[model samples]
Target: MTEENLNTSGNPSIQDVVEQRLSRRGMLRMGVGTAGAAVLGSLSLAACGGGGDDVAAAPAPAPSTTPISLNFPAVAKSTADLVTVPAGYTATVLYALGDPLNAATPDYRNDGTDTNFETRAGDHHDGIDYFGLNAAGTARDVAGSERGILVMNHEALTDQFLHAAGVTANPRPAAEADKEIPAHGVSCVEVRKVNGRFVYQRESQYNRRITPNTPIEMRGPVRGNALLRTKYSPAGTDTRGTINNCGSSVTPWGTFLTGEENWSGYFARSATDDTARGGATAKSVVSLARYGRPQNSASRHGWETAGAADLYARWNISQTGTSTDGTDDYRNEMNTYGYMVEVDAYAPAAAARKRTALGRFAHEMGMFGLAQAGKPLAVYMGDDSRGEYIYKFVSTASWDAADASPANRMAAGDKYLDAGRLYAARFNADGSGQWIELTIANTTIANFANYRFADQADVLVNARLAADAVGATKMDRPEWAAVHPVTGEVYVTLTNNSNRKIEASGSGQQSVDAANPRAYTDAPTAATAPGNVNGHIIRFRETGNEPAATTFAWDVYLFGAEAGMDATRVNLSALTADNDLSSPDGIWFSRKTGLVFVQTDDGAYTDVTNCMMLIGKPGQVGDGAVQALEYTKADGSKLTVNARVGAKPTSATLRRFLVGPKDCEITGITETPDGKAIFVNIQHPGETIAKANIGDATKFLSHWPGNAGYGAGGALARPRSATIVITRNDGGLIGTDGTQVLNGY
Candidate 1:
């Protein structure tokens, strides 16, 4: 039989909602770009790649707003599931899903028999940061960006492919359970350029894999709280490692913050457990339903029933006991997750932390304002789910230069992440927005019927309830966010929402609003779902164009669509063949080049092109005129709202840079300090294959980096998500020029 004939079920064996699945704007680093004449927020200079010109060595004034030029012509969109780069640039795979890091670990056999995954690379590479380590490799070396450690989050795993028997089987095998446990989390590896190419150090002192079994310290408002107390950690001061780490950010203190997303889906609950049990209340049911984890919901993979021990059972976050307190049960076990994990990337051996003061929700990612001498530090975040809200945490203490490159990075996090005000966003229809503080002091939440706020910790743990109480704007899956390099404006990608519908009294749907205005059917994911398929990118600037300001103005910067979608509806950006996308998931500003990089994680427009990354020069907030949008209300009445809509993007303003393989998202973008090299990650490339056929490597939906020539010779390519590096063949900086903006070729 042919390789494709032996395996009959080639279609994707999707779980309940796939169980899951799962920048800069220009200043210099994603947030470290220059905003207007002043530099906006920035990650630590030692954070992630992209450092050239030794500004830290000899502090100089900001560079002039000179637009950078692109030497290569834009590549045409392709149907092949492979990494496509512009002319004159080369793309090389660095680390793939099952690749080994330490010398003790053997090379991946591609037979799903690989063990000790805790020491090997994880699956589904996502957000990443590059930290320049000193020659001794003990501390953050800001002066050098060429030789640094790359910290990437393994957002999720492609289960069926990870096991020999496939993961769809009801009772998960113990061996399969073991591999799956270590497959999710973050990876830290050392990478450096050789004579002409960048290479991954197989064995480096800094190489480490943080899996779900690793110990993580819990700090901030929810730390040491009774609600988080579980049988595992009665003190509630710590929790088992982080999971679903999607988009991530680097702190100014040189620590990596990985956001835990879709964590609630991993835990299972009983159908009859809605009544008071353990420490849960009626609000628990309401909160669970709102978060899409209603009672009786099956766990992501039935990990609880995998074995008799709690190793896999601990994943069941449902109300498991009738005890007055949660200490004797795992009911509150899941609450300890769903927060940002702080890792000292420079010190791979350091204990990671869960910063709860930032609030608990499906944290997509976090971005910080440029840490100024005397100004307060600001961090922006998003909740990646349907009808979720955007958030920001402002540090109470003032910024100090001494804290920038601190002697102890984690200690610096203690001063900021531990004492901050967590606030939810409320985008007004008048083009203005407000940061609603999620505090017990807010009357709307303190007396909320669904969930009462007994303390600050209660307010944060039940943050979703508080956001609903305060009437925060319901967004369409707020995924990754970015802050402009020079405008100090925050840009968030509202990936499409399928649950939205026209307002009807009994419909119980999310109606179109100023922030999430589109509700048209172009290529619906399903017959019943037709709201925002091709999503849009929204940008906002604080009242004073400063992150310190709570009030701001917002506008839809760019709408994602197919090249020929109706311009009056979905394709609002007027995207052409050169620049078109859907569900923009990852976004960043190359402050080093004044160009904005946008990536798509969508199935909405895969028919035309695989998920790709586009480069553009974005304008500041309010660059376009206000748009009056009409909507159908519950009574079939016309409801019009005004919004600061963005202008259509011309070919000169935006162009496609690279596209990924089948059933994958183009994510995790970073460039070397000198702007000579760029790194991007391809996630879950042959995801469409079924469990039964996953073992048949030849029949896999995609051959990926291997078929693309990054893998072994004549070997059956086992599709694996991996990171690839991009560099110029001419040996110049990776962009064309004029004023650093990637505007026109």
Candidate 2:
């Protein structure tokens, strides 16, 4: 997921809180401010000091009787126009952009004259999950490996390659708009092993595409509210489609959960939109502006300029309807997006449901924690924007083991996902945190100064405002999240914040603190982000080892940097040349291997290597200790904060696994039941080519899978986003030698 830089809340920073706490501590020691002692009792002032770095000692690690080891040698970093893996592994291209899903659909010509994209594979493949099929390929079978379904999100378009002569000017032709709209949603294709290699089943009955024009039902507290009433569904029970699908996860009830990210950029609003809605003080105007769609904002692709038909005009969110309830126009269309859409890949006839209980924002993914038989389930999520908050939704119902394989999966989703309590995280200056509930019951939310609350629906629709009122801690562009199979600990990827500074420059800028403590230029004169150019991963253990805990203990798991950089400051995790990385984006743990895989979507460290994936043996959250980091402010003054860091990662613990082709993001990985094979997505290779140079193949930055002989290939073939299956030559388990025993087994 990429950073959008849309957060302009100007909420107080963690650095500001730390400074005040330190001042209060000094006064308490001198017998002043005694009245405030009770309020600060829970705050963990475990480490604090002035000046140079003072490292705290960590406890001895508990020895593992049977340690997991990497069976293959580390792959060297490469800039070559091909996917590079270990010596013993082979990566074969599988499904790709514009591949046919129906048997009658024609093959992609690669010159971009193909039509009927509603039945073709979409662009920018991302966030994939594998669902196993029975031996007869008729039903679900968790143990089946040879034949299954591959569900993935097509995030956005590399539009320059979508048309025959590239994109046309404004007022885009209907033919061009027809292809682009269907290319932005999700795809489910059936795959089976044919001759010792995996291949997509082009003629399978399970293959389906859910695009922006597909119908979706609204579920949960905000379902039929007036805020969702539009010309498409005046009763507020349905909406048109899902857009900007970024990251995804598979549910315990056999459904696919996809996050709608950056959907605000797809709509265009008129300059007089605020005035028509009763000026800036109106609730609708304030809500629209807060979500990055201020009046007169232009759409990303100008889809609204196509024609006056409802198909094209819906992208224009201006309030031009004559009815006061907005029953004749798309004024309320934007409110239906920015949600977590649920899809049952096994059931082809079911429509996707938008679970409105998981409050709206720039959603990254929805990952559930370890499910216990009688405990309330918890789903961890992150909003993918600079200075946004991480969220958790606790289902009101208790988990039942039998529901894992219910006869009706979509009904099971309603039993658990339709009612939940939403909470936003607040990381403290110390190594502890709290989950602030976003409810009207909270006094802060009820009396929020910016927007008046109408009901629970209003609070959820404007979740960002509720989080701001409760003072949730702003993070560095939180993206994908993964839960440890063994410990049930959650780790989130803070994928680089370009708006960070040592001191605030404006409303959206933030300073360094314990959780996000780094501010330096990539190079002396480099034109990258000055603060946190390379991001880090933070992990936490829920209190009492329970998923429903209200508080947790946390630490920085690892920092992203060049291996040769300053050891005390930037390379705090002590990463070696074999495993160093930057801008960690897609992350997941293999349930069978207990190893965490980290993938990068970066521009920060690209000078040394392309975006890559690494395998690591992860330790507990508190495996390392606290360290005070010194920084120079904008005025040249010095400041420091004690940050809890994780253990140093050695070659034995972390190693590079794969590097993708030129200009491609290596995202969305999944494996079969036995873990013998893994599938990965290479998105938008050669995406940096100039729009005017689309006719000249020689000027292309990359011709990726085409050059490597996968699809339509030659020196002149255009690049594409594709999925590749990797397997060991010896037919053994993917990341191991197949002889090692797991801890319990």
Candidate 3:
């Protein structure tokens, strides 16, 4: 959006406000606006209709060898039908909600019969990555290998179905709630493709799970800080489990990094307890409060009352002790989470460590760029909260191919994550942006009146506070981010935020700005609260066209809106039924295929159709900039989005490839290096199934991957979360020359 317009009031549009506040250095960081040109150098669309030269140059040929296509328009009638792909392509249920993590433990009953889940796969699986296999059944990086270790992030539990029955009324029983706590973590399983079918090798030594009770070491600046000390780990040396594991990434060395998000609400802290634990002065309070934790409020699942054991006691964030001398039971234990955790996927039994060096906030996911030897590695992240900032981490040490050894895995992390400076971005009105370093040694951030920092640990523990001190521009809830494989430009999803408005006062009041410009009321739905329900995607290129550069150029790549909405503003590209979407959440750009996968997690338009994923061949950066957005504030004042228009994708160019079942989110995408096969995760299908009928497949909302009739004829077909495989029946490169077979024959 451009920054030229404002209403009667003198207040500048959000774009102008952010531009005025951006440092000159930050503008220079955006490659002085030339980064966009560098990214579009290859795709020349105007000369060959809407398709690129590559498609135009290729000769028209016979149909693909493996006529790949979707098996059905909507395989899932509800949440209970088994989803299938075209014949010759197969689908398998690898893991489901509450599937035990350790084979040493009992297998999942699947008939609403799961009880103990400390060792099982958690619910709501999200982002995932595939690691190739070695000859000796070990994890490796083979470009053409068909077998590998799969690392998946279990974002959170659909507690309504995890227990024997759903959550009881308020002040619920402790044992019932405790059953749901363990089902929220990360799962690593060994998988292989056999004769065109994928199966999980349960007996593989690399198959393991890490839950909330698992013992994990803390690494980086905040490791041993006094604020982190808890009764269970007196020295702040170890913590148990990780929750809210969202989008994740795989390091060049083969380790998996699961992001802990919305982790602050898991504990219960009394008002009196807040004061005893250093009160507001303690970084714990500021950290806890900023992360959405409310004092004296217990989590929806009550694990604190499970028992006197350390497992249950750790969930209590109350200050029960008398002093700060390690005796004052600082219930601030919950603050220790919400950081990026490193899991050794190849060694499933190994404990996952929380990499505090990455800086803690509401992390949605971490995306790593292609690693090059002797070059610094870069990671892009989004804080999944309205008005939060986007961040990136550059490893201090150069990459070395030799560091792939098991012993050197953590060492690689130390070199990259532990020492790098964290940064927040500020987009300028002139189409450029700057990455402001969020370090402690120098800057206005260090003198923040809210929290005092003695070292980098303080800076990380109170990252939001520090960012606020420096006046980093806030954005709509930022979700997943990906770096363009061919262009090296970075794209981020600004998921809808109801709280953002055009006014400066009142709850959820956010002035209309360039980065997050829309503010409109949406029909109320179970998935999202009304206002500003649909979202948009933003893309930028770094200064010097370098991934590690501090400055960059940016623009709104696409806006999410219905076809009937104002095409000039809301529907920037005039997206039609073939490509329109809302609340863009999960996004990925494939390097091998040059195709972008866009998945939606939305509530505003659920009534229209199920959530879907769109496949697109993007044109270039800065294709859809709008100089204004008409947003009326709570007061009488008006607001507008002042963004520089960039090339926008038309409906013909971006089409919906698939739609999920009822109450399900289409997430976790990865593909073979050759781009011949694609994998996607269908999470929490039939989630709306009533608690009373959880065990009955007939009445349940979904029975995916399990044929519908089979579950009704006295067949005990259990609904399970699964990974689906999609490959062309005539086996050919996907999306090549726009002639790839689609919509199953």
Candidate 4:
């Protein structure tokens, strides 16, 4: 759903029920937090400095793990309508929206007249993963990032650049949406570095596209459950392609795990379906409502009005079933999505499989925690919607280094991803946190009054409901999470929330807490936002620094802000022009270099600067102390939280790396193993431009890729989402540790 209308603070209909059970689950949280904190406290105490952060109103200090320091001159702020880089770096546009993936397809015309989307690249590129594929089109045994198959997700579409006159209105046209269908999935292409620059290899054997029309199989706990039965897949064992593929992660076994985000906006429902059964089906209505698809929800493009066959009819998730079991209609079609689908880059012809045991929600990514020999494995996931929960899945099987060498990666995923226990994070007011198990075995879950769960599969299918029963801590739009390569610290980005303290009477929305502390505004766009606008990065370490530990210690690492902002007014980082940023959404850590890569997707600070990417040194926990943050609550109450704060970022530690063109988001950052070449994605440039006035080419909001100094020579007609490669002009490792600017990796 679009940010303008999405219910970011969660479903109001279920808020009261969730709040009533939060107190009941307090004992579990304390028990878990105590043990986790004890383990983290000992391991981190000696590594971190004493409480010595001198910033005023900062969180109380704890022992911090010392991070490798940085030493590059910061880049300057700009609204230059192009990508801006430091003196030694060069940016090259690799592959872009509508660029043909095969030689048989014609080049993009750039005026929306292009067709046969299945043979061309899709729009709105987001998360990406690179699998080192050998010249024979097989997986490379080592981490050979220089030559690999790059798999990236096509998140969404800008109808104006897709259809000749933009998406149709009222009695929507099927032909317009026919072209849109194949534009919303994943893209697999072969790329290699030659003379220090990375380029996509057109027409390579690894080139493939998985669109919404492709076939996919179902696996794990809910594979054949009753809730997944539909007219197209009555057996509930298979389905068609994954849509709204956003931020994804790579499994240790070498497969692309794409997440389905904002999928609730794609299904249509009847206006009277909620009252059709006279409240007998009220439970079904609640499930749909929690997912943001209630009665009469018309869908983002009205794809259901196209036709009546299963091809189009399945888009409508209405309960117009002819049988009592719901097998004769498309009522349960929504359950088919909201899963992490795995695609094998080496085997392009293989069907993608949905790993349902990971649980269903507005999934953003599923990053695996640190993997060690003979240790239990875990993967961290975030539900991107505001006021949602962060989840972790622990595998039933222990880790074996040999599993990573499997010839069939998809088969290896079965031994790990298909069977696991999902846990939801509950961050406490203190400096500790807990990962509550979300199984039906819990008494509160087994006796949940809102929905009746029959078994573990039922609980997994309705993971959101299970989370609500256990009272997980509501967060502020959790987007992407990353594990520190050297420190074993976990970082999650809370990409701002506008509904932090604003609540309806009798509603159960959360107020500002230590875990999600700030509430600021974007006066240029939104007059007042009740939660963190320039979002902060929260980091934690597991008990005994083990990835599978249920307890952990957490603290806010950095709070985003603009230049010259008042420190008293919540510019908590004391930011300068070089290191200031907003809405830190995408993050990555290189174990080899011990550097953190940060990217932005901002609506708050666009007036000051376009979205950009920044680099910083990842430091230890307890480097700083408890901070005293002062702000105004929704009820006009003066509030101050004794929140934990970490080491501050100075000009030498955190610096801007690249700034995208107008209206684009800097997302999806990755690098070669040697750390010489880096790849970043620029998504949906000119997105905020009104579609009606786009016919006037001169009035088009942006002329990017072409305008952004991409000299490859494509038609300079409209702005397109594209992937760009960055390399040091001197052929040195890009932004190495302090005092190594001239050294090769």
Give the best candidate by TM-score.
2
Please tell me which predicted candidate would have the highest lDDT against the true structure: 2
Instruction: Write down the TM-score of every candidate.
Output: 0.90, 0.92, 0.84, 0.89
Per-residue CA lDDT of model 3 for 464-484, tens digit only, reads 766766666677778888765
Residue 108 C-alpha lDDT in model 2: 91
Query: For residues 119-167, could you state the per-residue lDDT of candidate 4 as single tens digits?
Result: 7889888888766655455556334656877789998887777866776
Clashes of each: 48, 0, 55, 20
Every candidate's lDDT: 0.73, 0.82, 0.63, 0.73
Worst 10 residues of 3 by lDDT: 47-56
Candidate 2 residue runs with Cα over 4 Å from true position: 1-3, 15-65, 524-529, 738-745
User: CA lDDT of 721 in candidate 2?
Assistant: 94
Better of 2 and 3 by lDDT: 2
Residue 445 of candidate 4: its Cα lDDT? 86
Question: 337, model 1: CA deviation in Å?
Answer: 0.7
Model 4 vs. true fold: TM: 0.89
Model 4 worst lDDT run, 10 consecutive residues: 48-57
What's the lDDT for candidate 4? 0.73
Model 4, which residues run further than 4 Å from truth? 1-71, 135-141, 277-281, 502-509, 631-638, 708-716, 737-745
